[model samples]
Target: NRALYRAKFDAVTARLSATLDTVTPPAGFYLWPKTPVSDTVFARGLLEKTNVAVLPGSYLGREVDGINPGANHVRLALVATLEETLEAADRIADFMAQCYSA
Candidate 1:
């Protein structure tokens, strides 16, 4: 499990390096990256465009003082097989390039 997590983590972080602010936790099976758009919008668009599902970070947080800490983030799970994880990362990278590239 650790090996799988490391591989998926490296692949995803490298793939998204140019497009998102990927937050690396000390140890986990998830990656929470700041999205260029609304987390809900990004998650929906990613699913619609790439068939890759992600949890909108907003779904994991509550609004505090009129600000949602996760309003602009998305959570990516690294629980798939290595091949699927790689494919998802590629699709996400491509999606980011198409929709959020500068």
Candidate 2:
């Protein structure tokens, strides 16, 4: 049932949060709004530069007004190793900084 599935998802997310040193969402219904576009480009540059892979938000039907809502956003896999993820995050940050500086 949906309730059971939700419970399992919450449990898994909790474990992932603990492992990743991230915060868990408050206990309640949660909606993961698609990542905004600004985040997408940063993520893509990171993956392309680092050889890591991620999905763009537009691929998830977040496109709007003929514009990709996630055009600036990238979808990272929580399943990747922590080190790989950290590297991706670092790359994204650097790329974004460079973009703004230019």
Candidate 3:
């Protein structure tokens, strides 16, 4: 099951790579992407405009010792079907273009 998820995750990341700054997911059903803007802004804007929800990186971990390692990133869960994940990725790319154009 893990291998299957990883394969799907890889396919999603490969498609998103052209627009999003994504690292190869280590494990689990999430993709941790470093967005061009603040994580909160990126997450909110995408959610509001494209209806693609993402978990802000800051929420995944604590600001340990006043240092937030996840401040500029967001998490995208690939727990849905492949088609849904791919569609969400496309929406995210469109949202990013809209945001950067202005």
Candidate 4:
């Protein structure tokens, strides 16, 4: 059910130290995590290395007052099967940990 997806999403973010900034999505399968680095870079690296697709927060917002409020964030949609979602979470956690520790 919905709870399963939310729980998985929460677990992943909790492990990554990535802030889940958006108010619990009212009705969607997305988890928006504030990244430790540029979101675009993070997204690209994730896709290239882990084969996971994440939307850079920059693509979800517009620049205003010389700043794109969406900077340093990425959006993940836990819309796959439970097994796949967990696997993706694991890969993402490792990817982010590596990026941050480097």
Could you give candidate 4's per-residue lDDT for residues 12-101 as a string of tens digits?
556555523434555677777787779999899999989999999999999999899888888888888877887888888778667665
Q: Candidates' lDDT values, in order?
A: 0.90, 0.47, 0.85, 0.77
RMSD to truth, every model: 1.0, 7.9, 1.8, 2.7
Q: What are the runs in model 2 whose C-alpha is more than 4 Å off?
A: 1-44, 62-71
Over 4 Å off, model 4: 18-27
Number of the candidate with higher lDDT, 1 or 4: 1
lDDT of 4: 0.77
The model with the greatest lDDT is 1
Best by TM-score: 1
Global CA lDDT of candidate 3, please?
0.85
For model 2, what is the alpha-carbon lDDT of residue 15?
A: 41
Q: Write the per-residue lDDT of candidate 2 for residues 39-78, one digit (tens) a residue.
A: 5564466567766566765566555678865454444444
Per-prediction count of colliding residue pairs? Answer: 0, 8, 0, 0
Candidate 3 Cα errors over 4 Å, as ranges = none
Give the distance in Å from residue 95's predicted Cα in candidate 3 to where it truly belongs. 1.1
Q: Rank the candidates by TM-score, best first.
A: 1, 3, 4, 2
